[model samples]
Target: MMASRATARATGSFAAYTVSELTSLIRASLESAFGTIWVEGEISNFRLAPSGHTYLTLKDEVSGIRAVVFRGVGKRLGFCLENGLRVVCRGRLTVYEPRGDYQIIIDALEPKGIGARQLALEQLKARLADEGLFDTARKRALPSFPQQIGVVTSIAGAVVWDIIKVVHRRFPLADILIFPVTVQGQLAGRDIARMIRELNTQRTSDVLIVARGGGSAEDLRAFNEEQVARAIYQSRVPVISAVGHEIDYTVADLVADYRASTPSAAAEAATPALTELVNRLQSNHTRLAHSFSRLLQQWWAKVEALNVAGLDPQAVLQRYLQRVDELETRIGVCVMRNIDRVKEHVLGLCQGLGYCGPTKHTVRLVERVSHLTLRQDKQIVSFLETKSRAVESAGARLHALSPLAVLERGYAIARHWPSLKLLRAATDARVHDRVQLQLFNGCLLCKVQEVQQ
Candidate 1:
């Protein structure tokens, strides 16, 4: 049998070690063997310590392993670690020297199946949604045919290359302005955002293509960044986000004007095909030419019909000569007839002149004026008499309702002297408050002594 190091520790003569020394060796061997590995289990007894260390046990039906994620790694985890949540943890395996036990020191964590990147994506999506970044109202429509397309993506990748190829092939007239940017890692988000802003400020593109090729969730993190999403939202030009595969989505994709499943799709969406445009132009030209030809033919037909009506200028001219002789005879007859009719009309008008004379009209007008004056005078008198009676009746009723009438019956009215407020009950006058007793003759101001209700 081989003598193990742990067993040799028992025999001091054979270079034995203390308990602490043995634990250190075991910890080093375990860490070295499993530098970084993934372990899957459901979390149990999850606890966050006051010292900012998370202590938890990862367990399956058969066995369990202890794990601790320090404050640094825990902060990076987008989701909260809770009891019974199934997860896959990545870290170095080693023994805890103080407890003389082996466990994993978690460097990173991911939820099983769906992965850890989703947690960050979900958190960002929720945050952006609350700010109304995903509202359909904020999205703009892309230009049907963009004069210039601004491409924001990494030039080194196939993404920009595909966009250029597609745009050039489909619509050569559209100018492609490439705003190269990093598409991944920590700095990628800032670069992407900066380029988007630059394109907007300069108005470089009629429409923008924020593109990238397919990538893992982690590799696509830059597109999910709030900065990139906000930049897309704030862009004046319409933006089409072509990020990752068809199955993937990001904050940028949601915030952009349109989402393309691939870079080629984005190019196709941004502009119309040149061939289709040419075909439409050709059709329009044909319709216009046909219309012009039809109009010309109609005018030509009218001219030919006029020419077909055979008539000599001499024959038409003789008709005019005959008509002139007829007009000369008509002028002689019409003049004499018109002069007779004029004389008859003038004689009749002379007879009617006296009927419309001023003297006759004035006498008739004076008679009408006298009759109207009599009618007006009678109406005014009748109206005045009725108004006078109404006034008298109203004055009599007003006298009866007057408060002074009650004083005339020997019933006095008591009012607060200073305020002139009528007092109906003794409770209204406080002791020593000055009161005014209004009688038919005069008013007497007095102070309240003993009140009786």
Candidate 2:
């Protein structure tokens, strides 16, 4: 505070200026003297503040200048600032009244050479890489066969067309959904990032491919932008970054699950080749056929080596039929013997009841036996009638299904003479040739006078 007062007195303006007035006057003088000056220096002690402003020291060989980038101006600076980076800044000078210090207020910053963009890129890589965004552990492998492939690229560009062509050539069954977004210019990054987030909400793709054709670094800046990089990192589906030629690289490539050299290569990586799949299927089929053929041969050899005492399949079947018939005969004989025994028991019970009433008992037993006999006869007759009716119904159904039924509808069947070949059309019978005609009633042998179509 004493130095400020002494400095003001030495300048002969102590009585004329207050502390705030002196600082303001100096700030105005500096601004008027150099409204906007360009300075080239190497940045040192660069730091970003919580307030979104930047604080830095711009130094040349023997001198250094304290510089500040306010939050609003700092926001528009495209590249990040770092120590040791040579930059050209455009800004005016201003004085801080309390501190009584003059510093350059930087409005814009640009790197010293073509390597400026590279420095920005390296800075970004270091940042996101530190956050583990580029870690191999976060990367995912693509599906063996993607059912639905979502693409983020410019629909009007050749990159999308190339991708479609390659994907179809490799696996025609794969479904492709293209989310056309800007791939260049200032707004491109935001558009691309939004598309990715939107696609995640849809969850429609088995895999995603973000691609753009090869171009200049500036033209491909969207892929390098932080928004696009984070978007790729946060994607739900595995993303393949195919942004440029093999020689080019972007932050997007680093954050993506897979990095493809070209758009077509990305498509190729996402799907299996159709021809190779077909070949594999055919190989499997052949192996299965060979296995079944060998199995059949083994069983046939076992069959040929077996001997069953001159019994063939037909003889074996006949033996089984004979056994069935014998079982049926024995069952019938057993049933008849049981019936006779039951009748005898009944007769004995009636005779033992009363010897004087033996004649009446005998007569009663005879009547009961006659009633039982009549019931048996009626049951047999009913069973025979049922079987006969079933046979007649079956015969009627067979007649209805037969082609001979067509004859009953006044249709006749004809065949060529001696050939026994049924004639289907008039042209089938030649003129003056003998023909056999079959009707519902009988057959007729006749000579054809003419054949007409």
| lDDT tens digits by residue: candidate 1, 248-332 | 8888989999999999999999989899999999999999999999999999887666667875556777999999999999999
Across residues 1-453, which tens digit of lDDT does each residue of candidate 2 receive? 557777889998754557787788788888898888899999998989998988999999999989999998876765677799888989888787789888898888888884656776888899999999999997998999899999999988899999999999999999999999999898999999999998999998999999999999898999998899999899989999999999999999999999999999999999999999999999999999999999999987766655434547566679999999999999999999999999999999888876656678789999999999999999999999999999999999999988789898888989987897999889887789899999988999999987777
Residue 202's lDDT in candidate 2: 98
TM, every model: 0.46, 0.57
lDDT scores of the candidates, listed in order: 0.89, 0.90
Span of ten consecutive residues with least summed lDDT in model 1? 1-10
| Model number with the top lDDT | 2
TM-score of model 2 vs. true structure: 0.57
How does residue 210 of candidate 2 score in lDDT? Answer: 96
Score residue 184 of candidate 2 by CA lDDT.
88
